[model samples]
Target: MNPRTVLVLGASGLIGRFVTDDLRARGFRVVGAARSLAPAQTMSALDIELPILALDTAALKRFLGKHSVDIVVNCLGVLQDGPGSSTGAVHRDFVARLLQAVADSGRAVRLVHISIPGTADADRTAFATTKREAERLIAASGVPYAILRPGFVVAPSAYGGSAMLRALAACPLDLPETEMATPFQPVAVEDISATIAWLAARHIGDASVKAVAWDLMQLEPVTMAGVIKQFRHALGTAGWPLAAIPSFMLDLGAKIGDLASTLGWASPMRSTAIAELRRGVRGDPSAWIAATGIAPKTPAEGIGRHPATIQDKWFARLFLVKALIFASLVAFWIVSGFIALFVSYRAAAGILIAHDFPPAPVDPITIGTSLMDISIGLLIVFRRTAAVGLVAGIVASLGYMVGAAILTPDLWVEPLGALVKTGPAIVLMLVALLMLDNR
Candidate 1:
């Protein structure tokens, strides 16, 4: 621990945070990395023992050059679509770049990566593929590496707002007689962390420096039927009932979760999370435990160790805030565009009336088309195109609203406030268009 530095990516994550704390307590100098500065600050302020690093893989080489890291731990994972979302290109590309940087740096003792338990033939989900690819990259890096795959990480109560669980709890129904009899094997989060901490210290047989693995949970195997019963019992939902959803129905549910996940700023259930819940994987952690001498803890012991408790309501709140901001921007754009269009119409009308020029039939249709574009703007409210789309929205709304206020009827609103609020968005679009033209 003296000169050995451990670099943990995605340090703000649940298991990642636990692993960081575990390593830091054992006297290891831990350098933690996350995409955002807020969580980094929280980790630093709470645990002064660990230093924080921003998750910029391109900067890894420069950062590592300043500090000597013995092992690089990749605990950065997601269940969403991409890097910041679930786990997509952001995860895959970053791992690839980080491994490449580590190889070039010629420093670091080993690369410890966290992997979900599965082979190539298992789940073809992007999560499995990205993780498998990450593992392959590290193993091929000529660096010593060890992979740990844990089983169902359990918590005592509601997880991610656990609305479904709550719905079950509140119901007056009969419990699912079949699921109450199934098996389950859960592992404590700390035990999983400890396994990594121990394995990081011990270099077992063959000295390959890279160990591919399946963490096989340390619990008496329980069935899904039993797990549901336990959940009901735990929640005091005695009379509540559950029907064994067919595998096809379960897959449909997952697809539904995925399809609508982006509608809000935060989602309680990621699309992929459903599949993980429906399917069970159990393995023997004996080799890993025996090799490192770190036993897996039971779910009862580890559930409370996780710190961050997410609720569905929180996701809803975040979505509301995001939606509000988006809606305001769109409103701003619409208002401004209408003002501009009305001004254009008045100028054209005054000229035509003065000269006795005829009006074109397309004028009304042009205004109508612009209005239609504004409605579609909401489709991209939570997407990357939000900012630009807002500008389009402003154009659409302002075009119609101003025309209605001036040329058509008596609808009054403060033009000054709309102008001030939406002016920046219009300018942003101008700048973006210029950039696009230059490109």
Candidate 2:
């Protein structure tokens, strides 16, 4: 076992989770840190949940000193600036503070920063520019560091853009012709962890391993279409006929994704994601291969290592359906409320009147319930309160069902079957609640 301890920031992320587990398996004393230690968010119970981006230099230094950290793996990143994320704060400012903390800690701590591929000139969005700025800061900081740029990381567990790819492949859909032809090199998550483990094995004072930046990816040439084909083959959908989706539909999806982001949903179909997808993944991994003597696994080898199981198929199929489910639930509640409140107030109030409710209390009860329905819909629109909204919707639906059964049981026998239909809606809300956790 390695006596030196390592700290992994963003330990709950797609890459960080794998890296942390890999290092621990390799006998390194690993401390995994993330913004949330909640069981639903974190991969393991051992992870230290802390607001890493919010910490200043002094606080970070103190944290490093307390843990006796020998190596720091920074996997923290954001796709775009939205409600709770800023590219500048996460990619640039945090790096600056982290570098300062390493220097002030006065420990021989080696920093392993996870970054993206492509040169600064091609950096179009804040995500790309801020990442480039962080790379420059690390190089200039004089800290013993290694900036690793991984291309199209293909992990066993998918999230964000990777998950999007899986969903597309399962549905047997391809991007536009131009996008399909764009270059997209891929690397396995295992290779990334292996490289980090290799670096950790060397002494920090070893000059050859320190202060290096390398692009990590397979040498094979691959396009976006080629990558999707690999996934299709893995998922047993290669023979399925693919429908060529128009570019405008993609643009509209991105716009919808941007709106979802403002509501605290970290959707992968946002504008920045589309722009980067257009740019495609590009990098040179020859230097990395020669330096570490680690042969990166190609997409085929990586995906083939574990055949797609029933669980994998279920996840891929449900990925997009989850969004649709939430959308329908939101619309269901809101529209129902709107019709009762504005379009059919007389029809809604008359039901209560027919049940022998007092004229004064009837209107108040109808208005209050209608507003509550709208509030539930609004709550479900935001990611943070989605679970609460789903639960409230379910409870409200049940309340209406019971109230109808008691006051107007004949309504259940009505040809429209409105009360019976509420049962399915409640079930849908339960499903939404179950699928609410992003991690």
Candidate 3:
């Protein structure tokens, strides 16, 4: 086959990075893209010089046409974000879009799609929903695509150092008295990628360069706890500390992710990651291994050669945790400010009413003034010059309160209510400004 050029979407992700490296090492040209600058910068060290393209369809179409690539290795993944938004979109949607774009070109391309194993079952998981949907779209498009469904991916490099392993590496490893039966064989990326490269190029007698899902199971199904131990031992560290990141907590974390996103924080509480933590997920890769006849890398072996891998991951995780703490502080301040505004406005309103029971229109100018204040107040989120924004927010809020007070002179609620109403915003503002100035 000609020197095949491959495009990998979500190429900056865990699996996507591995796949891109694997393809490049085997002498194939690979172009990658991910919606993150950190990962894009990190990718440059891999010795693979492919430019990171934007994952947008228009950009991709232009690239594909310009490059005239032979294959499309779609490591595309999604975590519940919409087309351009991030709440309702899925990987499958992106895959479907990619497939249609390729199919319409009439250039008969080979597709290597990396899908999660459980995605085969359309009923169980949301990730699966999109993966399955993407697969369906690919199949229906009459495209020659090979699906690689990897099971529990255990990175030996992640042993004692991975977030999962670290979470479990600090205490007495405990197994549930009643464990569910979600068996899995954690397969390494190298094994899965090798199989994909082989399959993408190998045109079978009747396979038509397109095959169904390749179940890239490790050797056997590993229970959730067992894998945790595997990671603990892999890290050469013991006394795993079990952090039971509950589903509810995961959802809560996801909610908080909105605030985190401002600082370029990726959602750690992925549904799939959470699902694995909860009940465990599994896959059978017998068909995959048999077809390719390749031995998968054990977690221990990979980590042995690359100890820094474990160390780097650990450090990165700690850094992110610190970032999250900073985010939390910012979020608390924002919420407190919102509450202050609400309380202040209500109290001020109460004092203004004297006619019969309630007061009447405060007028559009007053309302607009209040809204403009709130909007400008939004900028206090910035660390430097935050005092200005806070002052603006507080003054606008106070203006609303004072305006209400002027309107109703005989209302029961007194000046105390107004003070209390503005207390949080004022206190928060004063303290934050003082801290900034002291620094």
Candidate 4:
């Protein structure tokens, strides 16, 4: 093991995962920690030997006390913070908890917290608010710390905003371009990881850098449309033409997205996301370059360096496929429920009666089952209850199939193959359940 040991929290994330790899390449013994260990385990295939540990307050304290960690890099963050995962708890409170644990252990662990630009804006979102709170906590803790406020961190494998960029660029459908002129100083993810590694080596003890924050931005500012166009060009497919769309249309889309989110869709076109994009991300990189003696790559250079691979192209194309699949599944359940409850009530009741159900209770059973099917559809569409809904769907589909098999055995081999089709429906529910896992 190397003399220096670093613990990277949220190490399975876009930035943290790359940071772990970069640190390992730099010869530091890196311990990657996240809320779940399964995603971290996949890193083993990359030949990056690091202890992937599951994180919690108690486990973190135990690990810190046991391991001689020289530095602690917190890459933990979330975009849409809510009930199951609160931004206040994960960003602000967690930092305080980690700091208190380290203080209790009497270890001078150099803390490097990842934050984003625009936290100082007047109309900051919950994400920016929580990040700012975390920064304040680290500053007042009397612990050696370096807060990194990076602007538009881009990586090879895209998610969230970056994924949106790719979608916009690679879109085969004609899209109206709104807020095309929004400026951003995009910095490569690898550059951000390299900066973190540099700080880890120095133990962040520089007189000019202690408790100070650095804005890791590129040298040039590019418009949002320019970045997308550049990306398309880099992929060797810049032929797609973009037509100008009304700003109000974009605003309306964001509003619709906000409403959809309430109905359980994780649409990035939510009002907050749209507002953040319009706000744009720009910062002076002089402080960062002066301190680290490293100039980050420009937006064009960053995108050019990561040429579109076959996997990248496939991911870009398949993004819409996943969305379509989800929509189809939701529609099938709701429409089927409607057909059973209202459209084909007589037929459904007859099926129940043929299955030996009492004539008096057949109507009630049909109504209840129809409601359950609709509820399962709604639940599966939501991020929180998706797993429960998927499981319920699988069980219900299987039960219905088995019941039909016992009641109407001839339907399985009938010309229409009505009972045979349920097998694929059950399989699809299981497949959707697997895809719902964020890890």
Of the two candidates 3 and 4, the one with more favorable lDDT, higher being better, is 4
Instruction: Please give the range of 10 consecutive residues that has the lowest summed lDDT in model 1.
Output: 430-439
TM-score of each: 0.60, 0.98, 0.63, 0.81
In TM-score terms, which candidate is top? 2
Q: What is the RMSD, in Å, between candidate 4 and the native fold over all Cα? A: 4.5
Which 10 consecutive residues of model 3 have the lowest summed lDDT?
Answer: 155-164
TM-score of 4: 0.81
Best by lDDT: 2
Question: Each candidate: what lDDT?
Answer: 0.55, 0.91, 0.56, 0.76
lDDT of residue 357 for candidate 3: 39
lDDT of 1 by residue, 1-439 (tens): 2646777776666566667777888877787766543333355532323222233555677666766777777877766674245465545777777777777776646777777764567665677777778767766767667777776654333334233433333344322443333244666666777766765676434363365565747746765444434444444454645454455554564564565455543433455565555445566677776676666665434432232234433332233233344455556445534643565656534433454335674456545554555443453344556545655655754675566556543223445454344446555544433322100
Better of 1 and 4 by TM-score: 4
Rank by TM-score (best first): 2, 4, 3, 1
lDDT of 4 by residue, 1-439 (tens): 4668888887777788788878888888887776555543556433233332324566567778776887888888866654355667778887888887776766777888998776465547887788888888898988888888888878876766787777666675433454777777788898898888888777445766567788898877777877777778777678865566577877887786666566656666667787788888877788889988888887678887567888677666656455666677888888899999999999988876776777888888899999999998888777778888889988898888887778767667779887788889888877777666433
> Considering lDDT, which of the candidate structures 2 and 4 is the better prediction for this target?
2
**How many pairs of residues collide in each model?**
27, 0, 19, 0
1-439 in candidate 2: lDDT tens per residue? 5377889999888999889988889888889999975475454555788989999999999999998999999999999998778999999999999999999998999999999999999999999999999999999998999999999999988899999999999996788999999999999999999999999888999999889989998998899888888888888888987788899999999999999899988788999999999999989999999999998898889876566999899889899999899999999999999999999999999998988888999989989999999999999999988988988998999999998889899999999999999999998898888878767
Error of 2 at 368 (Å): 1.1
Q: Which portions of model 2 miss their true places by more than 4 Å?
A: 38-46
Model 3 C-alpha lDDT per residue in residues 186-300, reported as the tens digit of each score: 6776776777678656753346446677777667556655555555564555454444444455566546654434433344444444454454456666776677788776555
